[model samples]
Target: HAAFRAGLVVCPLSPLYKQNELSYALKKANVKALLLPGCESKQSSINDFHGVFQKSELDEIKKNLKHLILIDGNNSIPNFQGFEVHFFDKLLENDGNLSEEAKNSVTSDDPAALFFTSGTTGKPKGALISHYHMSNNMKFALAKGLSLNGPVSVPLPLFHAFAGIGASVYPIKHYRPIVLNNFWFNIKSTVESIVKYNCVEFWGVPTMVFNLCEYIEATNTKIDSLQKILMGGSPVYESLIKKVKRLIPSIKELSIAYGSTEFGSFVTQTGINDSEEIALKTVGQVADHVSLKIVDPITKKIVKIGEQGEIWVKGYCRMLGYYEDEEKTREVIDQSGWYNMGDLGVLDENGYLKIIGRTKEMIIRGGINLFPKEIEDVINTHPNVAEAYVCGVPSEKLGEEVCAW
Candidate 1:
């Protein structure tokens, strides 16, 4: 919030990132200043950041980085050569206010935040999100029923785009109070917080929701306050959906969202009024001001409804581009502004999207394309099977063989 008020772009890095990953991200983003936690809590310590500064790969970062602001630190700060160290609290105590001209200089189109992709495909790429993109995304979510009804519980890490933009930014923009969990997710603590705060809305990944439901079922805990849920960052299977509805009878809305970091978190989400079947099978319809199409990856042509193809989206929520990587940006975004989502899916007659699988993760066996999600879905139906993962392995006769675990 202070960064935005001062018209500076904010880039949040995951605390779990190793030294190499941290150095790479900082140098790649050309970070000029770094603000991180000091030796204040069990989650973080000043020694955790020593590796980042010691790495030789941070030559670029060392050159550009000028301020090393620690959230809570003593005066006995280590002398980082060529860097100025300051305590965050002491800086806040000073009355150095930004002028109106400085605040107003930041326009809606200007980059407000930089979020990195999860690097599941390869190396992480930074995506620049504009003020307009985030603001409109919040508006779209609110219009779809994620509003100021009650306190929202955010158990997911704030560094991720889903939690940062959807769970945090949206609530702040809409004046919705939020209950934030500082440390990693714990089922007991999460449940306690929700019940203690009477949180009505919950945001998390499908795995988190599944664990919460499992804990609730085992303990016979009743959380009557939770009314709305938004789960994303991965596929939401039917089994999980059934568990949620059965375990949490008070939940009036169980929305499943689908989007990428480049799309400012959520592009399509299930509505509160959607039927049980729709909620279980699809990722709902596209958000307002967004255009979606199914494109044949080979021919680069639009496919008919119900035909499986790559998903392409264009809208106000699209990121300006990958930060400082125009070559990679051009590879994903086309001339017409449509961004290739890189996920294979089918659009139903009713315009609902059902994600098939990632294009890169598709298995080819003896010239036949196989989506692992389909096999995993079938396996998960067995009463004994809790979960399953399917992949392709090299085969002598066939090009590839289906491997499951």
Candidate 2:
């Protein structure tokens, strides 16, 4: 809130990042001040916490980072050369007396945050988003039936948009409280928090949901307050959804949403009152004010209904651009304002979107087109299988051989 009011662009770093990953983001973003976790535990040791700046390749990170505000400090200041290290409480006690001119200087066009995409293939790209984009995105979220009326439990990391906006921004917008899980997801603690806090809504990925289901059934922990479960970040299997429903019959909705960092979190979400078939089979209709197109990746032409193609999005929720990387930005987003989501999906006659797989992840074996999702979906249905990931391996004659784990 303070950062938004001050018009400072927020770049939330993942706590799981090692020194190399941390250094790359800090240097790339040119961060001047950093907020560190005050409580040190097995997850984040004292040396591990301080080693990020100490081991950075850029000298400016050590020299220019002026403030190190501790999130849970006890009024004790840390010593650093040319730095004003202080507890977050101390800064909160100070009064903000911004001049009228300074207050009015910031506009809707100003960048509010720089969220980095998980760069499994290469270095992470920071997506610069404006204040206008975030505000409208939240508004669209509310209109799409996201429950903001009661306490919500979110185990997803805050660095990612799923928990960042849903757990932090959305609650503040609606004057509600949000319950956060541990630095990393712990099945027991997450379920306990829901029962303890009476969280009316919960959100997580498919794996987390599977874990929760296993835990709940094993221990029979009852969370009567839980009314909805928002699932995203990857495709969810029908079997997993059915298991969750059977395990927790009290849950009225298991919404399936589709989104990415480039599109400001949620682009499509299943309705709260949607049937089990609609909720389980497809990522329900696209959000209002957002336009979706399924176009052939090679020709860039729209595909027929139910035919798989690259998904393109044109909406107010789209990111401004990849921060400091116009070359990369132009590669994905075109001049016509359509951002090509590299994932392949089909739009049903009812406008429901069904994600097939990534364009790059598709495999052609013996001239036969194969999607990993199709293979993964089949593998996931086995009773013994918890989840499945299918990939392609090089083959002498087939070109690619399907592999599963």
Candidate 3:
């Protein structure tokens, strides 16, 4: 938050990243300094928390590194040898006052953050977002009827936009208390925090919600403070919602958010007062000032209402572009400013969007198109089947064969 207010473009790195992954992001972003957690006790060292800095590949880069700011470190800070190292607290203790001129120089158009994609298909692509982009998105969420207030608990990591932007930005904008989850998501700890802090609004992904429900059921714990819950990042099964409702009746509203890092945060979300049928059937109506259209993926033409096609979005919250990747940027954002989402969806006449699947994930079998979502849905209906995933494999006879897991 300090970095943001100070007009510095913050790029948060996920702790789950390995040496190579971390190195790629650092070099790609041309990072000058890295703020990381350091060992607080004599028995432990930051070597485990910051294994990327120890990599031999960073030897040359270390010389050019401006500062190695260590957070949570004791009086003795490790010397990176070449680079200037400082304890996090010492920097705060000697923090210089900022002039009015510096604060006024910042503008909404200025780049505020660089968030990388999940890299599920390839190397992560950095998406540069401006201050106006995020602030407007937060306002859009609030105006779209998301009842967010009071203390909120966010269990997601800072690297993800859901936590970094949705959880952080809105709370700060509204002057509400925001509680950060542990580095590792633990059900017991998460539940205890909610009870301790009396958090009314909560944000989570499907897995986190699932684990919390399991823990609550096993321990028979009741939480009366929880009022609203937002879940996303993956498919939110109806069973999961039912389980949560059954375990904790205090929750008055449960909504789902659909978005990506490229869009700043949430592009669409279920309304707080929306019926269970509408909330369960769709990703909810598109947010205000956001234009959405369904087009045939191959033809690039608008599809009939209720027909499954590629989803396209145009709005104020869209990222400026993929950082330093103009070629890839042009592939998604066209001349008219509409971003081809690359996901399959069907828009009802009422403007609600039902995400079907991804165009890239479609399978061609014997010259017929088959969507894995269709197969997976059928497979998941089995009483014994907990969950199912369907993919396509090359086949000489059928061109492609369906593989289920």
Sorted on lDDT, best first, the list reads: 1, 2, 3
> Cα lDDT for residue 66, model 2?
69
Would you list the C-alpha lDDT of every candidate in the order shown?
A: 0.84, 0.82, 0.81
Q: What residue runs in model 3 are displaced by over 4 Å at the alpha carbon?
A: 40-49, 146-148
Residue pairs clashing in model 2 are: none
lDDT minimum window of 10 residues, candidate 3: 41-50
Alpha-carbon deviation at 235 in model 3, angstroms:
0.9
Candidate 1, RMSD to the unseen true structure: 2.0
For model 1, the stretches where C-alpha displacement exceeds 4 angstroms are 45-47, 50-58, 73-75, 146-148
Can you write out model 2's per-residue Cα lDDT over 171-244, one digit (the tens) per residue? 76777778887767899999999888888888899889999999999998877788888889988877788888
- Alpha carbon lDDT at 87, candidate 3: 78
Better of 2 and 3 by TM-score: 3
lDDT preference between candidates 1 and 3, better one? 1
Clashes of 3: 0
Candidate achieving the largest lDDT: 1
Error of 1 at 261 (Å): 0.4
